[model samples]
Target: MSTEQPMAMRQIVVSSAEDIRVERVPWPDAPGEHEVLVRSRLVGICGSDTHACAGKHPFIALPYRPGHEVVGVVGAVGPGVSDLAEGDRVVLEPNLVCGKCRQCRDGRYNICRELAVFGCQSVGAMADAFVIPRDRLHRVPDGVSDELAALVEPLATPVHAVRRAGVGPGSRVAVLGAGPIGLLCLVAARAAGAEVVVVTDVLKNKLERAQRLGADAALDAAAPDLVDQARRALGGGADEGADVVLDCVSGQSSMTQAIELVDKGGTVMVVGIAAGPTTIPLHLVQDREIAVIGSLMYVHDDVRRAIELLAGGAVAAEDLVTATFPLERAAEAFAASIAPDQLKVLVSVAGPG
Candidate 1:
């Protein structure tokens, strides 16, 4: 008789606010049709993950596995999967959508009616190994390092927002909030050829970092005249605001500022997730003809462009990733990510393949 034990792996689960622990779980079964088994290498802690841990995120529930931004190596491929093979480095898109939905059929699967994120709503890639559909994996370029690959997921969101806002050569842009997403928006806007980009944040350190990352102006969000400051910095008068205002904070104050800071007929892209319902200036929106667009997660083309930006040196990973911890210390990593000074915190899952 032959006997063998099933493989086990460590997975991080957040049960409630400030409650996170690692549990040993059985390894995922072999990939079925069009599936691929991926061995996670690095995972980035997202702001939503922290919000869920703090019981603030409206979408993500408690007691969920927490790794959506992941870079991994393919371990095995199932039948019908031809493009990717074992040992290929890939990044997770994490969006699980229903193909029959209107949005999906229209090629906007990021907001599918039945959209469920892998880490937020289902089992995530925080484990040593995970099985996901082949279509959800984007092969990382050879020149991209593991750290840079891990950033593709986060960067994709900003890229999507910038594209939707129609940022282009000689465009004037203002980003509200200098966190990871905000800084990324700055980078994406600049890459899209924005003539001037102004970034705002309550944290002085974050503002300084933004200036170093090519922002034309980094203003203090708490300044009483922040609106005027941002407008002036964008080379516009008080009446002529920025061409596009990206509200990366998505709070009441930031959203209001976004509406006021955008030029007439310009766009106000809500790139961040609001913790709760907040009121906006509906009257101003109507009179100015401002398009208050809500940008959700990104589509596949956005991911491809994000990868290109990272691989082409448009987005520098070293400037963003501030701290890293081993998988065993994932809780510590989550803690570090919430630190006011930290930009991006990563958990080291497995070594580079």
Candidate 2:
């Protein structure tokens, strides 16, 4: 007699801003070709998820499921999937790209003409069980815990931005935020051999965390002479500047600061999503020939590198996971994510398995 138990599923749905519901859902059937069934493990609550819950995210539609930073265990694989199998730990790449798009043809699928995200654009993995394409699942190394593995999605964003900025040995980098993305960016930059990393944030606690996470210096963005402080941290006087400045905050002021802090002809990478338009010094950008680059969400290779970084202990992902709630308390988890004290909040879907 078969010992397998009957399948069950539950999903958290965001009806609107401040309206979240947990409902019993029908168990998803076996996967189709090119798809795999995943038993959701841990889902990290990102700022975008909270914005989507508040109905404020620019791209996320209403009445959608809201989890993209997800980790799980593969429970079943369809006919076309030959690599993954039952009980394999995995993380989802989330980006669904149309292969025929011009960007995808050029291997830049993060900007595919017809791109859809898993949680934001389609079904999310904030459930007891979910189905995703085989290509979207990346196996997690055995040494990485489910919680840490869940962070690969968020970490991939900075990996792409750091790579785009061309961080190399002895490079000087300034990161203008200490939030999850900013902190991860610091880790990525340092791992890429950046010798001088100065991080600035409005909060002292975040700055302290940034220091612990390998930032050579942490400054308060609210200081009157914040630019001077950052420059000093970078070992540069007022006239000297960084080789690259990463605007992880991406606000009007932060973008302006990024421009001011980078050397002439240096690179400035915009990683964060601003609330709206932020005026900038276009004249200075033109005069100095600063390479202003905008990094989109990760491509497949970025995800692979994120996994490598996490597995190799380049980033202490678990240190950022300050809180976790059960699937039944997802709303509480979302609320906790916005709290000032929490760094990364995760929902325990199947409780570590």
lDDT of 1 by residue, 147-180 (tens): 9999999999999999999999999999999999
Query: Where is model 2 more than 4 Å wrong at Cα?
Result: 1-8, 351-353
> Which candidate number maximizes lDDT?
1
TM-score of each prediction: 0.97, 0.96
* Residue pairs whose backbone atoms clash in candidate 1: none
Q: RMSD, model 1, all Cα superposed?
A: 2.6
Report, for every candidate in turn, its global Cα lDDT versus the true structure: 0.91, 0.87
Encode model 2's per-residue lDDT on 1-353: one tens digit a residue. 12243555688999865778787777787899989988888899887887777877778888898778998888888988999988899999998988997899999999999999989998798988788889998999989988779789999999999998999899999999988999999988988899999999999899899988878899999888988888888987778889999998888889988998899989999998776788989999999999998998888889999899998987675569899999988889988998888899999885422
Relative to the true structure, candidate 1 reaches a TM of 0.97
The per-candidate count of clashes, in order, stands at 0, 0
Best by TM-score: 1
- Give model 2's clash tally: 0
